[model samples]
Structures are given as structure tokens and as C-alpha cells.
Target: MKPKVIGKCIIEKEEFPDGRIRIKRTTEGITAFELYWHLEQAQEEISKQLMGLLKPDIIKRR
Candidate 1:
């Protein structure tokens, strides 16, 4: 479910029978170096596996 779009950020949530994916995104504001840092260390499937193995609150802390 997409709650709303504020400025460059889109706050949304995705739910499934067993789990979900909550995401916060921004189309602008970050610098190029920040983008590179995120892209370099990000895990694309970590969310899916995380939902399978852990809980949302754990992710919220990181």
C-alpha cells in the first residue's frame, strides 16, 4: 500500500500472506557519492530473505 508521496520521497508498504516489504524512497536529495555508497553495499534480495527469516523491527534499527 502506498500511503503518500512527500517531496521526493514515496512511502509505501507491500504485504503478502506470510510477509511484507516496507520501503521509503526518494527520487532526489542524495548526492552522487551517497548513491554510489548505497548501490555498492545494498542487498537486492535481502528484504525477501529477511521477511522469511527475521522480523520488521530488526530491519528498522538498521
Candidate 2:
């Protein structure tokens, strides 16, 4: 299925024949963003990327 827009976010989900499910979530705005899942291993990366996009100046404060 195609991605669906909900509020300011776009969400999509797919299931593989092998029983693996993938999900993608992102926001619609000036800067494009995306998140992917392949049975874990990139959660931290996604979180960091989201924080950077949501608050670019946050890192400078630390």
C-alpha cells in the first residue's frame, strides 16, 4: 500500500512473505525525512536524526 498522510506525518507499513514487517514514518515539511525498520538495529540512528531535524540548535546547547 502507498503511504498515507496523517496530520503532519506520513506512515506506511508492509509485510513480507517471510513474516517480516517493515514500517516507515516521516514528516511532511520543508525538509524531507524518513525512518526505516528491518527488524531493529537502527532505532538510535532514527532518534538522533529526528532530534537533529526537530531541533537543529539542540546539540549546540549541550
Candidate 3:
């Protein structure tokens, strides 16, 4: 399948007081990364083979 851009997205950059920088991409209120994750999972489901597994503790590490 070919990939397509379905909608508009927003990119944001932030600087912390400690001189740290963070960049994020979002669409509608959902972060683009998370949105892509859900889309990828859905695609895997349709293929009947979800190999892109993440550990249950992955969030804690992040």
C-alpha cells in the first residue's frame, strides 16, 4: 500500500528553563507520533500479523 497524507498536522517546539529543547508534531489534539502509532497498529491488525510489539513497560522508560 502507498502512504498518503490525510490531514493537516502541527509542529511545535519548546525550550525548557534548563536549556532543553523539545519538538512535537500533533494533529487535532493528539500527538502525531501517537496518532501514527495507532494507525500502524490498525494496519497490522488488518494484515493479521502484528509484529510491531512494544513492551508493557515501555511508557515507564519514556
Candidate 4:
């Protein structure tokens, strides 16, 4: 299935035939395309970036 927005992040889930499941979560942020439409006839290139708020949290799955 395709990823969908759940809360702040985009989440996707997949199930394997071997009884294993895969889950992924990605940050939903602004894209470069959005800048073009809003800016309209911009001078130079525009970009948006995201940075970690704090220390990264590592998750270990069994």
C-alpha cells in the first residue's frame, strides 16, 4: 500500500508472505515544487531543509 500521513509523519506498512511485516515512517516536509508555485518568477533557486530537533533516537527491532 501507499504511504499516508498519520499525524506528523508519513507512514507505510507492508506484510511479507513469510510472516514478516515492514513498517516505515518518514517526515512530511515541504517540497521544492511548492516553492515554484508560491514564488512565481523567482530570481534564483529556493530550497527548504529540515534538521534534527535533538539527539537521534535509534530503534532496534527483533
The TM-score between candidate 3 and the true structure equals 0.34
Candidate 2 local distance difference test against the native? 0.66
Q: What TM-score does candidate 1 reach?
A: 0.25
Considering summed lDDT, which 10 consecutive residues are worst modelled in model 2?
30-39
- Which residue pairs show collisions in model 1? none
Model 4 residue runs over 4 Å out of place are: 1-7, 30-62
Encode model 2's per-residue lDDT on 1-38: one tens digit a residue: 54643347778998999999999988874321233333
Question: What is the Å distance of residue 30 in model 4 from its true position?
Answer: 4.5
| Every candidate's CA RMSD | 21.1, 16.3, 16.5, 20.3
Candidate 4 Cα lDDT to native: 0.55
Highest lDDT model number: 3
Compose the digit string of candidate 1's lDDT tens values, residues 1-62: 54332236556666668786667654545665667667766665667677777777777789
Range of the 10 consecutive residues with the lowest summed lDDT in candidate 1: 1-10
| Location of the lowest summed lDDT over 10 successive residues in candidate 4 | 46-55
Residue pairs clashing, model 3: none
